[model samples]
Target: MSGCNKKKFPAAKDVVLLHQLDRGIFTPSISPFPLKLETYMRMAGISYENDFKNPMGPKGKTPWMTFNGNDYCDSQLCLELLASKFQKDFSSDLTAEERAIARSFQIMTEEHLYWVLVLWRWVYTKGKTLWDVQMNLPTGLRLVMPLAVRRIKAQASAQGLGRHSKDDVIEMGRKDLRAISDYLGTKPYFTGDKPTEMDCAMFGCLAQLVWSMQGSPYEEQMKGEFANLKEFCERMKEKFWPDWDQCLSPPRLNVS
Candidate 1:
């Protein structure tokens, strides 16, 4: 069959993504996991429909997937389920050691870098101000946003990243960026010419740092100090996102 002919057939199954709004644009919510899943699906060449039902899915998190008739929560679990059902192997070509390395990086980005993001965005005063402005809460509810902010702070503290001082947080983030840069070197992706789950994780976090958190100190530091990561974000954007330009555009805050 011709390549174009294959496009005529509908996808074997329907995949509905429940996450934040503004798909194909910058990270829409505070979390990057949802964007990671979306990017991974795109990279895997899977057709799926996006449904902005709520920021939190049935599991009280973003990036949950409903495949055919079954619900799968958690991005990693969703990826595993998709791979198993569709017979798609994202890491098939990887050696045992390579898979280990990739998995390590994935965990580092999620556990460490993710907390750095929370510290910068939810803990720091300047970051909180920008976040609030972008959030654009109503005048009546703006007074109560602090309560929500405090909840986030508490969550971050429990996660152990929000307890550090701002300088410490920045230093931690710098170390992570340096590590990712060193590992990537001149490679096109984390694993080599082809992208992997690790690449998805890295891109998801870096994209938010480089693009979504605009005007923040973290974003400035990433762009200035980590040129390679910035370039990698651009590469992934160009490769996986058809509307990269739109995604890069600054979000339209609903200030009313």
Candidate 2:
């Protein structure tokens, strides 16, 4: 495609601009595949590196596994989304093995901070306090743990499920976030460094949290919900979403 294709979803060069993992593994996580590659994605903490000097950070994280459960070619979730959207002649479409793998994770319907509770509980079992982006990970790590906790608490209370809610889930998410906010807190971002999966995950959870909190008289009491969380999301927008309007994918080429 030419650089000036009036509706080029992403300029051809920009199409693969900031790839993180395997190119094939990336598209879907960002949604609608092609457009996601045209835009940037948050890739701070969830990545695995050999050292502080990993030259291949841009090569994209090695696929955790292939969709086919054999040699790694791509991620299943990404493969299906691309296949369904593009319907292409190229053979990278999701295979039967890939479809089976995608089915495995269907149990997790939790979105945003709801899943953060899932992750927090998984990690809390290890008693690991100090977090290093390179070493500590569960993919969707917490950026602003306190905000995530607060958001999850808000999530559970959404339907007056407070008493009916699994108190343990609420308490786990709450105490983890509250404790982190209370102890060694508010550093500008997660890990007191750059943003990571934790930041994105926390941002995912709290974007709505802060949006909802705005204009309320309780803003002052919340300390702007702690500046670090707010700023981190802003930084995320700046880096990954320079042109939010460009997020939609273009019409498929109909390669077949």
TM-score each candidate. 0.83, 0.32
Q: Scored by Cα lDDT, where does model 2 land?
A: 0.33
Maximum-lDDT candidate: 1
lDDT tens readout by residue for model 1, 10-41: 22465544444434335443357877887878
**Model 1 regions more than 4 Å off:** 1-12, 23-30, 126-141, 246-254
TM-score of 1: 0.83
Ten contiguous residues with the weakest lDDT in model 1: 1-10
Which pairs clash (backbone N, Cα, C closer than 3 Å) in model 1? 25-247
Give stretches of model 2 more than 4 Å off. Answer: 1-161, 164-177, 180-186, 212-225, 245-256
Could you list the CA RMSD of all candidates, in the order they appear? 6.8, 18.4
- Report the C-alpha lDDT of model 2 over 160-208, residue by residue, as the tens digit: 3332435555444444445434421655544444432234434444442
Per-model tally of clashing residue pairs: 1, 7
Write down the lDDT of every candidate, Cα atoms only. 0.69, 0.33
Candidate 2's TM-score? 0.32
